[model samples]
Target: MIPQGPGEEDYGALSEQRKLVLATYDLCAVCALPFRDELRWQVTFDDQLQQMGETFAFNEAPVHEVCALYAAQVCPFVSSPHARLGDAQRKGQRRAETLTLAGFTHTATVFGHDSELQVGESILMFEMADLRRIHRLTGADDARSAYEAVLRDEARIELDDAERRVVDLLCAPTPKGEDSGPVMAGAAWFIGAVFCPQIRRVQAMKKFADAEGDLYFQLAANFLDNPEMMAEWEDSNDASTAAAMSWFRTRQSVPAVLQQWRADGARRVRDVRGRRPRAVGAAVVVPRDEAAIRRRRDAEAALRKARRRKR
Candidate 1:
């Protein structure tokens, strides 16, 4: 490698080839330590860990084993047979200690605290490649963390706004007698079951049907999860899940909410036409002209004749 002049020091930055060589050596040095405190060291595995490079202190068998395991955990790729080369060429290879330090620094930037493992109680360092290895060993850490967070009251508070938004969206008047099951399932119900309950609580207080003229169908669906609750709600009859959730305030009260949503939909359809006109031309209007009138009259007459024939 050409040494850089004092004026152009940055120009001699390590090439990709040099970087790889350094990284491999770094992996080897870390593999030299016996990271496992009490575990027996297998001779073959220890040799494999070093990739048959220079051995560490003769008396430090345990230390060597620990180092080897830590190296393996950090970078298994370097120990591969394909990469190990002849002794004559390897003599001038980069120092493993320097490379290991660089690799350790790199890992700290990439994996953060989550990538840290129990190498020793006192030494809490993260391996750059350990993030991928850890995830592969178990499952995604983020998924597990999110699940844990979901069960917390703080999680409910965090999702409360989004939950309210979903409920509000779901409550908007849809087609009369339309099954709100799928909608509710996707919206408020899904939020509570998959996310948090505080969101449902926030939504329950908002008047949907009376003030907004929309029913809290989604909020109601969340409560209907329990069979016993569904039964009680049916026996007592309620307005919506939001109402039932508020009134009952426990897991048992959900059924009443489901019953209310069911009844509210039925009553709304019977009491009001369940449909309001779109402002004049906001929707396509089929004009009641002569042709349309004739078609309508013919259809009515045909229905009447069919009924008479059936009778």
Candidate 2:
């Protein structure tokens, strides 16, 4: 449950502080732990899809695929077809008949400001990659199918050539005994290219540049003008990086480049931490599964203890 205020718990409303923590650390909304898998999932409604389509940015923080499926099956508001959304911010919105379980590999923080340019609200939005439709009428069965399908890796989006190139460039190891400044510049470029919307990409880049130094900004600008310089600077750099760096280095007008990559079947890829194949005969949990519920509770307790220890 999300806390609404001091000592007040709200099932429907999200805590602003919690949302920031989840976004900053890339933690799962359900387990409040770092992701172990490549994909992140979010629950969406038919009305949202109709308005924004499959690639729409989701304001809600993402959950683990398993958590999403489990919630779909067990959460009273989610599982009931006739129930309204009950979102405090948007009251009286009826729930859609079919809900979507959308998966993605990338998320970005969008900051909103007041007239004086003071930061007001920050929303963590995710890019869609894959999805499954769940019919609320069918209840647990539909949720179960979606869960099994994800576990089987069905409908998984693989990184394409362009995307793989971008990942490789961004993740390139800095040479031993060398200044990492250039590489950090590359990191800034990566953030600009992948994590920001076009409207704010330049602003994000400027912020990063200011933090690094004026020279770093100049170098980044040079890379934007002559992308081949990135390849020349590091002989190990690949042709793909050189090909893509033009738009990546220039924070301005990079969305078109991303759109082109997507058109070319590009999908984001990320490091998988502690992801291992499930053993044969492993228990597949469904709705009203007491064992699964207990396990989740245990995991949550352990996570809380670990976090407390870290503090």
Candidate 3:
């Protein structure tokens, strides 16, 4: 079933409850299915992107990469250049000439006060480190081009020397009866880079643990005991590993780690050649000022009036 709003299924407005479920479990908003190992995609307008500047949080839940492209090709408001964002909440807002389909590994759920000053609805926010692709589109043709580009990129993934070294370290067998701190650190990097989708963080961890056996658990315990080891991991050259450590430090137990991982997957690493480590997992609240609150209230009032007039 589609996400239900106040009265019925509203494709324009996502229910707050559904948003929570999607963010908490890392499910695709369109299909309501687990994301597993796939990259998460968010649709953004040029105006919205410009308004938010370099960093922005999305109120809408993320969709699968393919799902986002499919929606862009089929949804009238999204596919048509002449269409505008005509929902009651955002009336008269013209759609931007350029739409961006951003792919990322995971998103953090930001909770804060809404216009009414209550526990505000949760929204997904992510840092640049988590981003993998930023494909821009102007029409259905661009969606098809992007889909093709995705396939080409996936088929031709080429690891650089450093990345290859990291992979080799992760795949190397640990010496029997020895500590696995170094290898586990590499595992963290690999997981952050490769399989740490928001919907399957715990499953990935479980898989690695099962394969590595007692060594994995022992290293996890060591991190819990030393805690400082996590700090040392922050010094890792891999931007993704450093970001992952930021969230990992907060979780000390298996359950806590699993819950947080399911809530927000570790930040994926970006290319290291020209990139610097960026902060990750920070939460951003919506309607930061009084003007924004007033605008939201007016929108709701307008929507109610419109509904009554239609009836």
State which candidate has the highest lDDT. Answer: 3
Model 2 TM-score on a 0 to 1 scale: 0.38
Tell me the spans in candidate 3 whose CA falls farther than 4 Å from its real position: 1-14, 82-93, 112-129, 148-258, 261-311
lDDT (10s digit) by residue, model 3, range 1-311: 96645734232122443443344334567755545557778888776655766565675768878778877778565467675566797786655677788887766433322323223322223332267877788887888777676556543334433233323223233335322223343445232212223322221223443545445444434443344565555445543354345434443222222345422332221232234323332221222345543553454355446545756
How many backbone clashes does every candidate have? 20, 0, 0
**Quality of model 3 by C-alpha lDDT:** 0.47
The lDDT of each candidate is 0.27, 0.44, 0.47
Candidate 2 clash figure, as a count: 0
Residue 61 in model 3: shift from native, Å? Answer: 1.4
Q: Pick the candidate with the highest TM-score.
A: 3
TM-scores of the candidates in the order shown = 0.14, 0.38, 0.41
For TM-score, candidate 2 versus 3, the one ahead is 3
